[model samples]
Target: MGQNLANHLVPSQDYDLICENLAQTKEGADILRLKGGIPLANLETVTPQLKRLKIGAVLNGKELAAIGKILRSTSEIRRFFKEITTPEVPLPTLNQLLIRLESLPELTKVLNLSLEDDGYVRDEASPLLRSLRRQISGTEDEIRQRLVSFTKGSQAKYLTNAVVTMRDDRYVIPVKTEYKKHFGGMVHDQSASGATVFVEPKAIVELNNRLRQQQAKEHEEILRVLRELSQEVAPYTEEIDQNMRILGQLDFVNAKARYAADLKATQPELSAENDIYLRQVWHPLLDAKKAVKNDLAIGKDYKAIVITGPNTGGKTITLKTLGLIQLMGQSGLFIPAGEHSRIGVFTEIFADIGDEQSIEQSLSTFSSHMVNIVEILKHVDDKSLVLFDELGAGTDPQEGAALAISILDAVGAKGSYVVATTHYPELKAYGFERPETINASMEFDVETLQPTYRLLLGIPGRSNALEISLRLGLDTMVVEAARQLTSQSSQDLNEMIADLVEKRHTAEEEAISLNKYLTEAEKLHNDLRKAYNNFVSQRDSLLNQAKAKANEIVENTRKQTADVISDLHKMQQSAGNGVKENELIDAKTRLNKLEQPIHLQKNKVLQRAKAKKIFKEGDEVLVKSYGQRGTLMKKAGNHVWEVQIGILKMKLDEADLEKIAEEKPQKTVNRASVKRSRSVRTSASLDLRGKRYEEAMNEVDRYIDEAIMAGFPSVTIIHGKGTGALRKGITEYLQSNRVVKHFEYAPPNAGGNGATIVSFK
Candidate 1:
């Protein structure tokens, strides 16, 4: 699908990789092996064809290869297929392959190829064919049995081996060179050493005649059968060829889809109304585990982005990713990016991206770049994507910056999406001046003095030439002298840009820190909520249990009271109102004692647990059961105090807080240090075996989240060997996950390779 601009948009190396991933069958491979892009319309039929192929099981490689050969013209297949013999692909294979072709169903159904000998026309192809084969079988058997008897009787000693062997398709026996005249009817062949002769016995000569006659008749019958089958097939050869062509196209499409799957690539959102917005986009040509992700936006805000950074900070590579991803997307190939990445279909993509200064072309670097740019301008339109690397580089700085800005303006006037990279400070300043253009920078770590490879949008980059020179053993006097030579405005601008870069870095670091803490706080909050609910539930359950037991005791006490009262009443009745007052007093006392213990137990169980200790602002307090420390901001009405820890704030119950001695207070967790600590104890992989699908994925999600937050470049997942359901589920999850860049099966010796190694962005 991407044959036209491929040469310009992708390097030769990357083009080869894309083609390699797009080929399956030899025909498909041959088609992909071509250097140029095919028209997009040519790929339209591929979808339905692919859906058809996808419904069937994977075809055998040999069978697929053979079938692919049928679509090749005789001239194209000449090197591999000689004119002397035609490949007699069995009818069954052809029929099996063409099972879905409506026109050839009848021919395919009646074609019996089960008894075909190695794809050759079968002896049971027809009744006449079967009769001819029967005669041959009978005659051959008679010859073999007679020969076996002869060898066993006396000729066994003369033969090299006792079994009958075929020479020139005729049964023969190996006899000693000296004894050849005695045993042979006709010497069919001789050994290279002249030590043995393969001969037909005189006794079996007549039998050989009969077998040869039958074989001749069988050959004729086979030809007749073949002719009959060929006649039936000839009428539908066009349809058969068409089906093969469709199959090959499907194979190519499937190969691309499979490759995308392997690379964890996604079909980016296609937006015709907007310019490109690539989120966490990575170059498919680079190693997924190592490639840094970048967020890029062109249009909807600015039509062009001028990226600047140190050499090899991916300034050039960024240009290439944008160009290649556009080409890939328009070509119906998935891009290596996160979901929600939007790419507009470019009518044309023109790239002057690499150092095309050709000595052989007798052109200087600037001339070559200008030459390509001139050509690019001629064809660029509103629907085009233009990529330029170090625009106007091989020239004077003043002229180059002016030229670059002008080129961007010209391309922008065409309404084309434009991206260019340059180190010129003047160009960086121009980015601020232009209303339709913005500046982006590749981040560099000041502490490690290395490239972080993170692309920061909306900030210009400063050339760290002075700082780098000073750090790399340059004399302070020389650096100061160089600084003095530069204008005050230039120096001031450089300082401002450097400060901005540093501040941006700090801001990003703070964000990551905030994220980590928020996650921890959330987890802690959930745990606390769970524990509190459990405590309340258990308390209520215990209270219910206690009240139930008390009720039962009260019921027994009431029964006793009733019995006492009844006895009193009986006494009154029996004694005519002369009941015993002592018995009634004793019964009431027993009832009072039973009710007293219940009141005391109820008072103990139902007591309110409010804080007695006073806590105020600036106090270091521990959130009980949370194992976290926070500073009290203020008391919020009745016993609820607001606590602050870093960016986290919450109102906690008085009982949930315990004032802690400021000495040896709960230390704040350092996110960077937490990330670095993975070097100490974290294993590179997480194993999820024998867990249910939901349970396994839940654990996998947490494991991956922790790994990402820990700043792991990559990690492994061991889901054990099974029916591949677990691996598939995990893979799908990874594909949709924001943290995962890409994933692959682990190498051997790391549990089953069904266990995948995941990379994080």
Candidate 2:
């Protein structure tokens, strides 16, 4: 979009809504100006630093937000402090400056006392400022004590109420109307009913006088403090101003993000290819819930599309959606479209949309449109997006259609993308006559007599005048007569359009029915597949249960046979000559037969174990408990192995030895790729030579994780001990990492306090 396009879009429906939203996020006028300012001349060459400020607050013994607001305002600061007395340096306008400095940091090196998130300078800028505040607090306490004593004394009788209230910054008591003369002090104010008077008693007059004196001193001291703060700020006025500008830019950017979120917008791919392919794009100006999303393509084969439709059928809105979204993209705002949408960088965008005629300039609608089109044609190029509405509709139909065609040809010759809306029948044929243009229309329901607002491409629209007239109760004879009066060719074209719309509508219904059936079939297929899987799982579970029971029975039978054989042997030994050798042999044979099944089961279990066993005599494995890698020397026993780790052979459980995949030869990496990877790597060491405190702290987190993953025994972080902030932050982070066994400052021979060495567990 061109620089001039914003003005055209600002007047379009809801386009300015975006600008208003951007204005709301800004905190101050300085930022608003920066957001509204003209584009930079050359962004590539601009390296100006953004202005920034650190602030602290002065608590006046309250947590009231209103008081905080007053304290933060530039106008309030100026009113309270009055003017600086010293003539050494001139201060900037106080009403625009947020703070006034009285003493330099040399008197008190303090800054960054946050009062609020929007950011305001705290009153405690220096040590002198803090000291003066303390004195004020003490004086206020004394005054409160004096007022309490007086209210409890003889004056308690005259006092309408014992409560003390302040009037014009002076501690006052409410006295009864009849006893006003008894109080030998000035009356400040009276109640609305005049039933009582607020007075400062003469008895505490001396205390009040002392309090006043202290306040005067406080005021003077505050002015001095503000002047000192102002002096510090004066040196960096440029930086402060720039900070405001950058903050405002960010505020606007954030607003756009919020607006895009509301619209469910996606970021569009940008290109200089001079093509636009939009999908599921809804007009931001229209109600998104009801809006019919449409697809539009331009600068691909065709340079222009002539859209025609009945009145109020959304041709104009489609044009506006195209124009507005393009402007939004060029201005760095997200477009409300699908991820497939792409936008080309156009140097200029021209629009003759709506009725932009100027009566004050004595330009009729046609003349006004022509004047805009002439300017557009003179400057439009292959990189421009030009739009027109109701093109050539305010003049004679024949001449207007001719002129519209001529203009489309001109734009096409220049290779610029153009979209125009028209109601002229002759103009509808222009799209067919020109190879670089196509026709589109908004769909309308013939039966409901309502516009669908659905843009249908590759289709020309009909006027539908006769049908509307007939529906409005016009004489059927007159409507029929009007249709017959039109040329045969025109009548034939209208008949063809009617037939085409009917066929498309029927096809759409059939397609919808077919889709519904397909969806149902797919659901049924998924359900059957899920049922089959469940059946297979149940069958496997039952089979495993049966196999377990059979094994249990075989073990029990073998145990019984062994016990019986043992008893028989005992009996035979005791009864010396009673049993024959054959009978004893038969008993042993029976025992062997019972034990065969147990032996076969045992052999099957051994075979399965042998199938899964990973370690061999020569295979290398890692001993996790000892954190060492070694080869398996031999198999010691069931579920255990003898492994040699670092020349020491020990019997270990198989679970203790983890199988390590043999390392493959490292793939050769190009020298350039190695350098690139290193530049982006956070390895066993991190060097924060010149980074800020925040950046250095963040980098430390990534550095530690990389070192642990790389299996480094120890890692070093170099954060030069400048003011010790960076070093302190890095050390604190290192302490939080669970992987670190210990960390300490490097020795003097190394980087000393400038670097920390950490050992990982």
The clash numbers for all candidates, in the given order, read: 3, 19
The global C-alpha lDDT for each of the candidates, from Candidate 1 onward, is 0.67, 0.65
lDDT tens digits, residue span 346-412, model 1: 6677888777777898999899999999999999988777888899899999899989989889998
lDDT of 2 by residue, 1-761 (tens): 12222233332123234333223222222222333321222111011211222333232212222222222332322333344312432323222332432222231232234233233334554565567667768877877887787688686988878898989888888989999878688889999999889988787677777778777876666555544444444454444344333333433444555566667777765555657777778898777777799877776557789899988999888999998888777665677887647766677789998777787999888998999999999998877889999988778888999899889889889988899999887877887788978778888887789999888766788777888889989999999899888778866765676576457545645654687799999999999999999999998998899789889978887787878678787866766555433244345545544533223354787778555656788777776554456778889999799877543455788766777666655797211110111211235578998998878777777556445434467878888878988887877777766667899989999999998999977
TM-scores for the candidates: 0.52, 0.51
User: Which has the greatest TM-score?
Assistant: 1
Per-residue lDDT, model 2, residue 106, is 30
- Candidate 1 residue pairs in clash (backbone atoms < 3 Å): 3-36, 3-37, 4-37
**RMSD, model 1, all Cα superposed?**
28.1
